[model samples]
Target chain A: MHNTLLTTHYPQLTTQQKNTMNKIQILVIGRDADILQAVVRLVNKNEHWNATGTSEDESAIELFHQHSYELVLLGGGIASDSELKLRKIFTLQNPDIKIIQHWGGGSGLLKNEIQSALENNEGGNFNIVDNPFN
Target chain B: MANTVLHKADTRGDANHGWLHSKHTFSFANYYNPERMHFGVLRVLNDDTVAGGKGFGTHPHDNMEIISIPLEGDLEHKDSMGNVAVIKNGEIQVMSAGTGIQHSEYNKSNNSTVKFLQIWVFPNKKNVTPRYDQIPLNLEDRKNKLQQILSPNPDDAGVWIHQNAWFHIANFDKGITTEYQFKAKGNGLYVFNLKGDLTVDGQLLNTRDGFGIWDTDKVQITAETDAEFLLMEVPMAM
Candidate 1:
C-alpha cells in the first residue's frame, strides 16, 4: 500500500531513485504569519528541500509528528516559555534533530545558517559566505 | 549480558586545521556519522590539541552542557559573562549554555601545545540561566580509585551541569581491578581509555578506545598497565 501510494503520487520516480530519495524537510515555527510564510518560501526555493510553516505551537507539534523533519527553525517573536517547551518536545521525539533559533536576518544570512547546519550534520565543511543569495 | 558498543581509537574522525588538530569520538563539526551521532544523552567527545598561542575564536553555543578537561599546558578562557580564567592540567571546566553564551579559548603558552578533552552532554532543562564553573583537581586522589569530577549537583565534588550525569577519572596500577555501579537506574556508562591498556566487562581496550555499556547495574574494569581513564555516566534516554 505504501509503495502504491508513492508510485501514484510520484510516477516519474523509479524504484531505485525512490529507494534513495531523501528530501531535507524543515519545520518553521513563528508568531508572525507573514515572516513564517516568507521563510517557508525561501527554503522551498532550494532544490530537494521542503518546508512547512506554522504559527501555533499545537499545530507545529502536530506537523512535526506527522512528518519526518530533520530540522526545526524557531523564528523570532516566540515567547521564551514557548520556545523552551517546543525544544523539549521536539528533542524528546527526535534526539538527533537539529533545532536552530532564527533571529532577524536577511534571506542570505538565513540561507547560510540553514546550509551551515545541514552541512555540519552531514560532516561537510561549514563555510559561511557573505550574502550568496543576493 | 549487558548491551555494549566499542569504538577503537583509529576509527575516530580526525581533522587537522593548522592551529588545531582534533579527533571526534562521535559526530561533531565536519565529522558526521549517522550511526555515531551520539550515545544516549552523551553527545560529543573530542580529543583536541591546540598549537601554542592559538585557539578557538569567540563562538556561540546554547542549551548545551560543555565540559573540558585539560591534560597538558594551559588554556586561557574568556566569555561574554565577563569571566576570564586559565585552566591547566589537573583541572576541569564546565559551561552551561542555557539560553545562550559566547566564549573563546586559547593556549596560554607561546611554545608548548595544549591537549584536552572536550565533551558535550544534552541538558535535561531548557532556557536555564547560563553559568560557568571550573575547579582544580587533586591528582593524587585519583590514584587507583575513581575521583568524581562532574555531577548534576553543584554542591558535589566537581562542577555541575543541568543534566543528570556523573563523570569520574582514575589512574590505576597494573593488576588493579574495580567495579562501577550505575548512579541512576536508566543511565548508561561510557568508558574512555585515556592512556595504557585496560579491560571493561571483559573487553580489551587500548589507549584512546571508547566503550559504552548499559542495561546492567555494574561492570568490572581491570587495568592491564598503569592506566588512566574517564567514566561518563549519563541517562540512556533523552
Candidate 2:
C-alpha cells in the first residue's frame, strides 16, 4: 500500500502507479508489480483492478473492504520468522478471499499442485524432464 | 554491474491481427535472426497485447519452459496438455511444453484489453513430456514484500520455471526499504523497475532501469516513492 499521508499531494503519483496496477486495487506491501500483476491478471478480469492504490500490504486490507476484489495475491518467503504474519491478516480481514503463495525459490505451491494433480488425475502434465543437450 | 550477456535483441517479424499484437524478443519462424536467437537460455520474451475480444489461435511448442505473465487484462490459455488457464497481473503460469504440445491464448474479457508478457526459458533437462501449472498470487503478501513467482523446484509457492533462476515481484512504498537474499546456489539477482522510483545501494532506478548485481549474498532495495519492481535472479552466465 502507498503512504496515506504523503500520497495526497501528488495526484499524478497515483496515476503513474495506475499505469502498472491491475484491475484490482492493490498495495504491493513487500512484493513488486510483477507479482501483483501476475496474480491480479491471473485471477479476475475486473476493470476495477487497481492494486497500485495501496503501497503497503497492511493498508490494502482497508482498501479491499472499501471496494472488493476476487482474490488477494502475495509473495511467499517469510524472513526467518518461522510463522507468517500476513497470512493471519488475510484470514482475519477477508476470510472470504483466496490467498495464493509460493516461496523458497517458489517451491511450495508447485509441489502441492503436482502432488494433488498426481493423486487426483493419473494422466497429467507431470513427467521426467530429459536433457536438451543430449 | 553483474555479468549479463546483453543481446540488444534484433527486431524479429511480428504479427498484428487487429486484436492481437505480438512482438518476439528473439527470432521466430519466418523471422529468423541467429544473433537474436537468445540471451543464454532465455529464448523468447514476447510482448503481447490482445484486443478486447481477440487473441492467438492454436499453436504448438516443445521442449521448452513457457511462462506467461499478464501485464494487464486477462489471458485465456488452452493447451493440448489438458490445461485451460487464465493468467493475469501478479500471477504466473508455467508450462513445460516438453516433447510436443499445442496451445492457444486469447483475451477472455469482452471489453477490457489484455496485456501480457510471455517468456521462454530452456529447460535444465528437456523432453519432459509436457505439463502445465498456474498459481494466482495475493497482493497482501507482496505489500512491501518480494514474492517469488517461479523457480526450478516444484515445491515452491508460486509457479515453476525450468531454469536455475527465480522471478520475484515486489511493490514498495515510498521510503520503504527491503532486502532480498539469493534463492539459488551460485545465482545472482537482476533488478528491473518497471515503474515508480527505487534506489539500490544508493543507485537510483527509474522506469525500465535495470541493475545486475552478482557474487554478492543479498540485495537491499529502498523505494523513494510508491514503486513496482521485478527481480530475476538467474545464472550469471549461460
Candidate 3:
C-alpha cells in the first residue's frame, strides 16, 4: 500500500528509482520521550524516509541546524505557544520545509499527513484513491 | 493432581526507560528469565505505563494473539491492515498477527499517562489472515462476579481469539466469594490480582501477584478486601 502510494504520487521516482536517491530526512520534535521514540521507530520503517527525534526544544533546534530535514512532525505534547514559536523558527530557517502538527492519531494518519505534505510541497496533483477524512 | 505455581509481583522483570515503564511477567524484549519464559501457551504478560502522547511504534509480528486492555486513559491503534481505532478504559483490543503484520499503539491523551496490559498467546491456528477486534466492556456485569471478556469461539460470548481459551475479569467487594471452573479440558487458569486483597484456593494474593492453577476443575476466590482481578484459562499443554 505504501509503495503504491509513493509510486503513484511521484512518477519520476519509481519504486526502483527510489533506491538510487537519498532518503528524505524527517525530524520529530516532542516533549514526551516515549512519543519521540515511537515516531522515530515508525518513520524508520519506510525505506525512503530517515527519522531523528528529540524531546528537548533546544536539542531539536540544534539537530535542525546540523541536518537538512525534509519534514518536521510536531507532537501533540508540545504546548500551542511553543509549537507556534517552533514553526516560526522552522520557517525562518527553511521556508520550504513542511511542518505538520501531529495529533498522534495513529500510523495511518501519520502516513497520510506525510504523503499529503510532500504532495503539496512538490505541487503534485496525482490521483489519491481514498481521502479518509473527507 | 492439582498443581499450582506462584509468581510474586516482585519477581517480574522491570524496565523503565523514562517515558515508558513496563513490568514483564515473562521474558520480553531485553528482559529474559529462562525459568519464567512462558506459562503454557501464554507467552507474554506485560504491565505498561506510557507517558502522555507516547506509545509503541510500528512493529512486525507473526502467529501471535496480542491482546491490549487499557486500565486508564485511551490508546490509539493502527495496523498495516488499515485498521485505526481508539480503545479506552473498559475496552479490550485483540490482534491476530497471522502471516505477519505491522502495528503501532499510542497514548491518546497529552496530559495524563495511560496504563494498560499487553498479553500474548500462541495461536492454535497458524498462517491465517490477520484480524483485529475491540470489545467494549460493561462495568456492571463484572461486579462481584466473573465477566467473560475473551473466548475461543468466534461466535461465543465476549471477544473471540484463535485459541481454545477464555478470559474473565471481576471486581469484588470485601468478603465476597466467586468460583471459576475450567471451560475446557486440560486447561489451567492463570489468576492475576490487579488490586486489593484476595485468597484463592487457600492461598493469599496481593496486588500484581500471579498464580497458575492446573489439574483442577474449579478454583474458589474469596476477597479479603475489595479486590479486582483477571483470570485467563488456557490449555495446560501447547
Best by lDDT: 1
User: Lowest summed-lDDT stretch of 10 residues in model 1 chain B?
Assistant: B28-37
Residues B45-160 of candidate 3 have per-residue lDDT tens digits of 89999999998877665556889989999999999889999999899999886655678899999989999999988777655578999989999999999999999988877888
Q: Report per-prediction Cα RMSD to one decimal.
A: 11.2, 23.0, 16.9
Highest DockQ: give the candidate number. Answer: 1
Q: Which scores greater on DockQ, model 1 or model 3?
A: 1
Tell me the TM-score for chain B of model 1. Answer: 0.99
> How much of the real interface does each model capture, measured as fnat?
0.00, 0.00, 0.00
Residue-wise lDDT of candidate 3 within A29-50, one digit each (tens)? 7554544555677777777887
Q: Name the weakest run of 10 consecutive residues (lDDT summed) in model 3 chain A.
A: A1-10
Off by over 4 Å in 2: A1-134, B4-17, B22-39, B201-203
Q: For model 2, what is the alpha-carbon lDDT of residue B27?
A: 53
Tens-place lDDT digits, model 2, residues A70-105 = 443333222313114555555566555444322111
Comparison by lDDT, 1 against 3, better one: 1
Candidates, DockQ:
0.06, 0.01, 0.02
The backbone clash count of each candidate, in order, is 0, 71, 0
Off by over 4 Å in 3: A1-134
lDDT (Cα, tens digit) per residue for candidate 1, span B1-238:
6899999999998989989999989766556566675687787899999999999877655556889999999999999899999999999999987656778899999899999999988777655777999999999999999999999987999899888999999999999999999999999999999999999999999999999999999989999999999999999886
Lowest lDDT sum, 10 consecutive residues, model 2 chain B, at B4-13
Better of 2 and 3 by lDDT: 3
Give lDDT tens digits, candidate 2, residues B31-119: 44444444445555666788987787665554567788788988899987678877788788888865456677889998999988777
